[model samples]
Target: MENKRTEISDLGEFGLIDRISQNFTSVNNETELGIGDDAAVLNSLGSRIIVTSDMLLEGVHFDLSFTPLQHLGYKAVAVNVSDVAAMNAIPKQITVNLGLSNRFSVEAVDEFYKGVKAACDNYKVDLIGGDTTSSMSGLVISVTAIGMVGQDKITKRSGAKEKDVICVTGDLGAAFIGLQILEREKQVFMANPDMQPQLDKYDYIVQRQLKPEARMGVVHELAELDIVPSSMIDISDGLASELLHLSRQSGMGMKIYEDKLPIDKQTYDTAVELGIDPTTAALNGGEDYELLFTVSMDDMEKLKKHADIHFIGYVQSSDKGNIMATKGGNEVEVTAQGWSHFKKP
Candidate 1:
């Protein structure tokens, strides 16, 4: 049977908002008001609130050729939550604004919202409120995540002290490798319409690019263990770039061991297959959504046995400079090569 197609014009703007509003229920008590009103209300959870907003452009931020609507929706919310998690805060609510072109149908919007709703449930955040408007070009998603953290629990990039241990949660470079695979598949399909994408071998990396989770688990674990990171930042623009940001902000230098960088087996093999260095991918690959943080040496023993956390380096005095100790025992100046929005492709 053919699926029914409903146009946005059929339901109109108010009707579409109503349809989307029904799919999400407020999960956070702080979300005193969600949807239906001109504004959403939130009960202050803490003395400090951390707010972060991220915008996703269809062509620049993501390629719809290989991205599913559901995955895109989930990714939109997850990426925003990642920023909040980086501050060592618990995300409470998110407001999603979408600009849709005529090409998007009512069912297409519903499919997108299903993924958003799934992400909200998984992250334990409430969909508060947002605006829906028409667009002349492509689908645009802007998400603002609101989170709360106590003054003492809040983490920043500038808190690192000399000799602080640099730790990273989860493996890196899978997302970049996933993008390579996706682009390769897209080109192959474009060249031949009959060819189907063979992606079983690349499933891990592909999924990493499609649907990434914020490191809220790691944050909760640190709290449970009564361990607070001296500094923290999410690994969105790759390890090397984020490290530079921390160094610059904290007025300190860093020394990271190349051999200590975590890379998944699949990511390593795929990078080699693609004629790219695995270390390069780990350093410069963007969109990992992992957390890179620093803990005082005194607290090292508490997290030393963590299975998911990898100690990659240590903070150094400003005179030492940002450097990476290679596997061959040579130190090289760390460079920032992460994603730059202004760079022309």
Candidate 2:
């Protein structure tokens, strides 16, 4: 039997909203009022509340040709949670707004919410409220994540001090390499419809691109260790770009050693195979979603033994400028060559 298809038009906007609301129940104590209200209510006991919103547009941020609806839904939530984690806050609630074209069905919407529910469970956040509207364009997802952190523990991009140690969580560049593989496979399939995508060997990098987890565990670990980073930012737009953000915001120069940069073996090998420099990919490739932070020398000692955190460099005076020391022992200026929404053609 063929799968049943339900038209979204059959159920009006209110009906669709009711269907979506039934699947998500509030679990967070802060979420006093979830869906079915004009606005979600939250109780922030004594902590500082942080809010972040991110939008993903089809044919821009993602491609439906290879992206699964479930994965896209999960990714949409994870990216916003990453922003919360960057602030050293615990994500508590989210409001997901969607714009769907006629091509999407009620079943398709259900499948997308399945992924959203999975992410809510994983991140321990409540799906409080959202809006759904018709769109002439493809799918558009906008997730607004709300989190809380102690007044003393919140980290920002402008808090770094001179001599602070710059640290990064997890390896970089795998996501970008994965995108390359995906685009290549897409082209191959376009050229010859009969040729199936050979993606078994590229599983790690491909998954890195498709489903990235927010580093909330690291935030908890830092609290347990009594370490608060002086500055922090998620590596969404590549290391070089994020580092520059920290440098400019904190008014400090950054000096990172290329040798200390973390690159997974698979990412490195794949870049080599594609005639791309691994270092270049690590520095300029975006969407890694890892945390890049700076801590005092004393706190650095505490995190030096962390298996996942790598010490990449240190902050310096503004006069020193932002530079990276090459493995060949030469220092060169670091530039932002990462993702830009609008660049001259």
Candidate 3:
């Protein structure tokens, strides 16, 4: 008998998601959404519920050699919280599932839990439940978060209207630049095990990559300012990819200013040092974990003084297509070069 085989690359990341998602039908009317979006929105008896999950694997998501167990645990929670914030909801509970290999000691597991507990306390979320199992290959961490938001307060990627001003929290590219530096240092150490890592100068970007903070404060501040973004999505998959999500979901196009795109000084310098275009990194670097949202033009004043958020563009008619106006004053079509774990082969 001949074996059937197909390459994961042929489907691509989005294709795989779509193919898998097609089989599952939303049985519950309360499940306003299921897959594809920053988070899933469900209608509860009272307030609406926001649910999101993320899974991190040892070799794929992080390298145990450099990434601390504590930070990994904390980051797992932070990424989940960031999704809840994207829905303009308050995270309440999270259930974690972990798989461990014998290489890890009991103390190492305890350290991971400490970080998880710290994140729960900081986010004001309950560590309601979890499961642990033994794995033969590598460690695996999966977390699912539940949050609540008022019906009117809930935001979705589809709510964006034509002409809505697109905004993003904080800068981009730092995390990717940080990853580059870490890889370089890792290689240097490999060639000569005695070599000390040159990490002091790359502290900012390194932290940005390893200990990324979810912009939960932005959600609180937006509420305080009385400005609810018409649509919201988190920047887990590069700014350019996120913009395309907003545009496709909202049935609109956009024109973002290249000069208006935000990048930290450290990120810009590191990108230059690595012979990478800073602007390209800002557009395509994943793992940023910041919020990318859209708001009414009139509400712009409410966020005008926000130090971290930058207004880069506005939604346009869908026919014009999503574009970025370059610093050179030319428009270029936005493409998604987001991370695809399926590309491993």
Candidate 4:
């Protein structure tokens, strides 16, 4: 049976908003009011609130040919939440603004919201309000997440001191390698429609690309362990690029051991099969959404036993420069070749 398509024009904006608003219920007490109002209200929560927004364009940020609407919706919320977690904040609310073209139907929007609701549930956040409007060409998603952190507990990119232990949560490069596989399979499908996608074997890497989780678990664990990262950022634009962000903001140099970099077995194997240097992918492949942070040496023992946390390096004075010690005993300046959305073709 074919899915029924209800045109946005037929329902109009108010009707569409009504349909969407009915599907969501506020989960956070901080969200005093959600949807159907001129503006949403949030309680003070007795802490500093952090806000972050991200925009995703159709062809630029994603390819719908291989991307599922459900995953895309989840990712949009997760990425924003990752930013809040990087600041050592607890996410409370989000407002999503979507630009849809006529190509999308009510069913498509419903699928997208289902993913959104799932993310809200997972992150313990409330959907306060959002706007939906027509687009000129393709789909556009903009999400703004609001979170709270105590003044003393908030982490910034500029807090690293010399010799602070650099730590990263989880493995890397799987998402980028997954993208390579998806692109390859997309090409194959375009060439021959009858060929089924060879994706079952690449499930881990593929899912990493599709549905990434924010390191809220790490944040919560850090709080439980009574440890606060000196500085932190999510690995959204690859490890190397984010490391440079810390370097520049904190006015410190970094020394990371190449051997200490985290790469999953699946990511490594796939990178090699795709002829990409696994280390390079770990360094420059973006969208891992793992937390990269620094902690005082005194706090190292607290995290040493944690299986997913890897101590990759230490911070140094700015005069020493940003460098990575390779496995072959050579040191090279870390370069930023991660995602550059504005880079010209």
The lDDT of each candidate is 0.94, 0.94, 0.84, 0.94
The residue-by-residue lDDT of candidate 2 on 1-345, one tens digit each, is 029778889999789999998888888888889998789999998889999999999988999999889889999999999999999999999999999999999988998998899999999999999999989989999999999999999999999999999999999999999999999999999999999999998899999999888999999999999999999999999999999999999999999999999999999999999999999999999889999999999999999789999999999998999999999999999999977777786
The residue-by-residue lDDT of candidate 3 on 1-345, one tens digit each, is: 013333434555576445434434444344566566765555665887788999999888899778888888888999999999999988877767888776665456656766776787788766555566678898999999888888889999888888889999999999989999999999999999999999998999999888888888999999888888999999988999999998888899988999999999999999999999999899998899999999998888788988999999998999999999999989999999887778866
Predicted candidate 4 versus true structure: per-residue lDDT over 1-345, tens digit per residue: 036988878888798888888878887778899887888999866989999999989999999999989899999999999999999999999999999998998888888888898999999988888889899999999999999989999999999999999999999998999999999999999999999999998999999998999999999999999999999999999999999999999999999999999999999999999999999999999999999999999999899899999999999999999999999999999999987887987
Q: Name model 4 segments beyond 4 Å from true.
A: none
Report how far residue 345 has shifted in candidate 1, in Å. 6.4
- Model 1, span 1-345: residue lDDT tens: 029778899998789989999988997778899998889999886558889999999998999889999999999999999999999999999999999999888888998899999999999999999888889999999999999888999999999999999999999999999999999999999999899998999999999999998999999999998989999999999999999999999999999999999999999999999999999999999899999999998788899889999999999998999999999999999999987888985
List TM-score per model, in order: 0.98, 0.98, 0.86, 0.98
The true-versus-predicted C-alpha distance at residue 300 of model 2, in Å, is 1.2
Q: Which should have the higher lDDT, number 1 or number 3?
A: 1
lDDT minimum window of 10 residues, candidate 3: 1-10
Give the C-alpha lDDT of model 2.
0.94
Candidate 3 or 2, higher lDDT: 2
Question: Which 10 successive residues of model 2 have the least lDDT summed?
Answer: 1-10
| TM-score of candidate 1 on Cα atoms, chains taken together | 0.98
For residue 180, model 1's alpha carbon misses the true position, in angstroms, by 0.3
Residue 71, model 1: lDDT of 92
